[model samples]
Target chain A: MNGFAIVWQERALFLEGLWNTVSLVVAAIAISVPLSALGAVVLVEAPRPVARLARALIDLTRCVPFLLLAYVIYYGLPQLGLRFDAWWAGLVTMTLYNAAYLAEIFRSAWLALPKEGFEAARAYGFRPATLYRRIVLPQIAYASAPLVGGQIIVMIKDSALLMIITVREISFAANSINANYFTPFAPFVVAIGMYWMLSLIVEAWVRRVASGARLRYG
Target chain B: MTWAAFETLLTGAGTTVALSLAGLAIGVPLGLALALIRWARIPVADQLVATYVSLVRATPLLTFVLFVFFVLPTMGLELDPVPAAIVTLALNTAPFNCEIWRAGLTNFPRDQLEAAEACGMTRTLAFRRIVAPQLWRVCLGPLVSEMTILLKATPAVAVIGVVEITRAASRIGAATYDPLPPFLAATVIYTLLIAVIVQAQRVIEALIARRYGYAAP
Candidate 1:
């Protein structure tokens, strides 16, 4: 192939990897948000032992490297007679990791809510469920949007770890390309560019949503 | 699965802890220096510092490890996996620690420094006697959290062939033709170590706060 042809081929390969990265991130984040919200509510509303256990679990989950977690779930589950379909290992592991972080973000936002607001709702004869659904959840989402957005960005970066678990994600695809080409610079650099672009998009979207919420509620 | 192999994994835990401590030893001082230089508003250096920090923060840790291990060989420096892992880990952690310390230093009370200057103390002496101690108090939480991060991040070093717990687990997996037992053992060890570190951080932070008469929540 001529130089221009080779360059075009590399670009195509890179774009495909970029698309994969985006899809994986979307899949991970799409499911993670609600799971985290529910997990956060449980941690906060449950008794002291439950809260302590939840916090410990979050810390434990966050401590292990994503690659190691991916390895465990990918390879360890089958031995326990629980074999996931292709892509499930990566998705499940990433979701679990992101959920832990998202839970912490939501928990902090929950704790930061004005006690007076809750008190007023309670005094007005609102049930706990009604108080949470009507008054508290909205405020917590507003307060936690940027932080939760940041966590999602971190989660996207972490999805690269799924490559180790045999997921044909962006980094894994890039690595295969590099192996065939015998040059690390092109494929790896392209992957980095993809990550940078995706993260920039995430940050911009987060800012826009934050401003929209402010305009609506301010 | 055997007790004997479990003992080997336990030995590997020591390697992980040692690598983490080594990274901390190098990273903390280097990070503090970079933080000071970056925030000190020096001539022509501030922009460079900011750029360096941005590059490090934006790149994935895996990329950093791959570059250091694979690319550095062509540059005439032949570093072993452990050293390479340490270099990357320390470099990765430094930018974070630098930012944390810089935030602490910048947010420290301005009036106290002014008061020290008004008392006719030299600038270095003022920072030493007045600002540094106060900065420590403000930075305590972030510092503890960053250390916890360092401990947590040690597992990444395994990627470079360091015989840390994760690396050891990989070895067992490869040998046994089974990944579960070793990986599960590593996971348990990792979870336990992290719990211990978190608890230790809380205790140390509480002790420091109490000694300084500052209430810890």
Candidate 2:
């Protein structure tokens, strides 16, 4: 009761943290999904050596832990004459880590598409960019909506790790409240509830879009 | 990184592997048991299990890790860093495995069990002889993926001072003020480690498929 009371008293801090977390995820998804689509297209359409290089990089990003990658980007980059503020570094790392995962997803769905559609687009004399824009992207996006939703939730969760680099995201704000009020349980549980709510909303939205895609495209 | 730093990272990687394996060992069976409880539809127990899975699936591993490490002590269940980490990993992964196992259980062909019962096989024997192998064959791929995710999550334990590979990298960076070498080394180690897991999964999946005549999955 006392711990929760403290959390309620500092509701402003939690709300602020929640907002930062939302902004990070929205920004990360905006950047990562386009980048992922580009990477996926490259993997499927590029020449052998270039495709292989893309595959290797995607696999590397997939295997590396997000937190470790963030640490590297935050601490190691300056040595290479690259300097990003911790906030931008967090966003960039989120983009890098989840882009690989989403790219893998999109790439597989792209491969699974029927060969006739692609060949038909080619024979119609459609430009390469037009073929991709009209045929390739829409089909993959529909097929991959559910998985992309899952990854979006993952990105939301991973945003909490940015607190380690002093980004003052939800978990950081909760932790600071703990540091001040010595109420660990209340603040973290509150922060996590917000995350859970965000995930549910994303999932519901994905379901809506997927059903619509099915009606329109399937 | 110097040779000493390399040695330190190796040691940290070892700890990471050990913790993840221990967590997997506990989580797999625990998940199976939970799935069974839900499958049986035993009144309140089934509903409890469902809620537990949903709740766990909704939260992040780091939030769960922080909760166990920081909040558990106030409830009069204090634990050291390593044990707390193992607990956190096991708790976090079990719900995922539960879902995987439940999928196999629900989708299992009911006629096989009926035929076994008509053959006068006991319920235990029917499950042991028929259901278990097929479940393994069905669940192996997703189970392995979960294991890899758990391994990737080991770094979250570092917050409470477990000094796994990522933690060691951070420490080395702090000591030398040049994080590139150690972090790069850590990345290589983690990549190689996960590759081993994936490769082993391939070997195991091939074996299971051959033994069970796996078809679609």
- The prediction achieving the highest lDDT against the true structure is 2
lDDT per residue (tens digit) for residues A31-124 in model 2: 9899998899889889999999999999998889989999988988888999899789988999899999999999999988898998999999
TM-score of 2: 0.94
Per-residue lDDT tens digits for candidate 1, residues A2-88, read 323343576766566566667777888889889889889889888999888888888778877677777777776777788885478
lDDT of 1 by residue, B105-187 (tens): 78766788788889999977987788777766666677767776666666665656677787688778877878888987888
The DockQ scores of all candidates, in the order shown, are 0.44, 0.74
List the RMSD of every prediction in angstroms: 3.0, 2.0
Lowest-sum lDDT 10-residue window in model 1 chain A: A1-10
| Inter-residue clash pairs, candidate 1 | none
Global lDDT scores for all candidate models = 0.76, 0.88
**Best candidate (score: DockQ):** 2
Proportion of native contacts present in model 1: 0.41
